[model samples]
Target: MKQVQKIKLGISIGDLNGIGSEIVLKTFDDSRMLDFCTPVIFASAKIITFLKKQYKLSLNFQGIDDPSKAIDGKINVMNVWKENVNINFGEEDPEVGKYAFLSLEAATAALKNDDIDVLVTAPINKSSIQSENFNFPGHTDYLARELEGESLMFMITDTLKIGLLTDHVALKDIASVITPELIQKKIDIIHETLKQDFRIQKPKIAVLGINPHSGDNGVIGKEDEEILKPTLHKIREKGKLVYGPYSADSFFGSKNYKNFDAVVASYHDQGLIPFKTLSFGNGVNFTAGLNKVRTSPDHGTAFEIAGTNSANINSFKEAVFKAIEIYKCRKEYRKLTQNALKKQGRKDTNKKLFTKDN
Candidate 1:
């Protein structure tokens, strides 16, 4: 039997005070995961040791100084910093935030340099992880800046996929940001990402309306008719399969989302509220349209449950697996596209040569 290539998964530990280390350690506890991919965590070995002793969870992982030396049989911790930052499990501290940034920065650099095939990020406190160097809203924005591409916040699960037209923005400002141009741009990215990243040949997407009842056909708001409706029409006219300005209220309740490959919400809550309610503990927040692959658990830092050792590792594990799946899908997609292009070039050359001879 031919051996399958194992991908190297780079993990960025979120706020050390939170469940980042716990979830990471739990997800890697099972030795079966190592058969699929090699996990390289960008965190201090001391933190892992402390967490292991605290939780009394028996898991074996090796600490490596370099990512290239990461072995397939063990979860390798690549030290980002040697300092012993204090971990106040439930309290937010500046030092913890500093280490979080350092881990993320190092892991992101490794991803860009192709040292790792994919990145599985633990939850980071948006408020705490702020500093002079990290001033963005969250991971998506920070990664977008580093990777130099438009970021599409895609929430994924086994049953459903949702993409936000506007991510991490104020609800009051949503109306202004939901312009036809922005909708079109996000739809284009979602369409392409679905085809390439998820391996969907012809993806069907549904777009939710900005207002309730889809503006009641312009009774409540005109954004749906004036902006979204026309944009969806334009997108469909371009040979892309996209539909609706559907009412956010009834769309999911009526199970209309089951008919499409993905749903695009006009703002964050419109998409995420229902998403979390449906798959809170298992959904993976994938940052689409970036040159690099990054996936994070849909839930937040869970500060209240930080040191209790009760945090669910399901979401984090799903994030890791999802990243690997997307990575492999993208690789295969690239190969297929490149081969098709080469074959087309050969046909074009033959046509030109035959024309000249005739």
Candidate 2:
């Protein structure tokens, strides 16, 4: 196969009523986004025109019927929605949800078929997206289903990378899912992904306990002592640098989380609460183990400020940058591995030739 020149990124323009369209326009409006990848937006041309006229965002749009028609240095809009629906800025109509779902579905098809290198999804409103077919909480659950259940959600920043064992579940049911096997699996996924995607070797990981004081050895909660602790031990035995059962209360104190590369929390809040606290409005949520790469801005669809041109595009920018970073990381690692193999092959050939001559 020939090496592709440009990195093709399939961008889903999320709920039209939300700020998804605005941020996406702002993100691609700058010429810098084209420097890294060819962005193909799966959205409507009429909506793009509406946002440009309403918010006065400086964006040039060229509509394309095929992903292959996307051009560099310009925003490409692929109208997955054949008919244009009346868009109400900041209003949650079911039309926005339907279009958002179609945009996402189109993007996913392109991604699954290797038509795009990565997917940068804009925000989707959960309440409005309640059709019989569109019942996901957000992209994480939806992508998980489409990818056939092989993925994990992690909120990431330069400091404090967090992995959630359970997401968007009721707090009461969190403990039931906190088992040693699951943590081991999550850690394994985190470890392998960091190596493959982030190029981290011998990643040092920290695991958070389910209970305060880490159950204080069953005084507070037995899940920590019975389940979490055993998992940490078994992981350590496998020559992995895994630690903790540390109370989440003091874990973020004094910036101690920086000592480890990544941390695993038993539930949603335990991990994300700290992650969002530090990186709000600028965080990138990465789905760590998907066969097809997926990422989104950490913040939600800001419906209140949807098309006012008031929404900050920082998180979306960060998401695109991270996708590029991970792509380069994967590429470099493969190059290094190939080079090493080639060198080793030369060394083996020299040894065999010397032995035969003797």
**Model 2 lDDT tens row, 1-358:** 9856778888998888888888888888888778888889998787778778887767788988888778876778887876767788788788678888999999998888777789999988888777988887678888888874457888887776888888888899898977767787788989987887887899998888898888998998798888888878988999999898778989997687999999888788888888888888889999987776788999888877876789999999999888878878877887988999999999999999999999
TM-score of each: 0.97, 0.92
Best by TM-score: 1
Per-candidate Cα lDDT values, in order, are 0.91, 0.84
How many residue pairs clash in all the candidates, one count each? 0, 0
Against the correct fold, how does model 1 do in TM-score? 0.97
Name the regions of candidate 2 deviating beyond 4 angstroms.
Answer: 1-4, 338-358
Per-residue alpha-carbon lDDT of candidate 1 for residues 27-92, written as tens digits (9 for 90 to 100): 888888898899999997887888889888788888888887888778889988877888899888
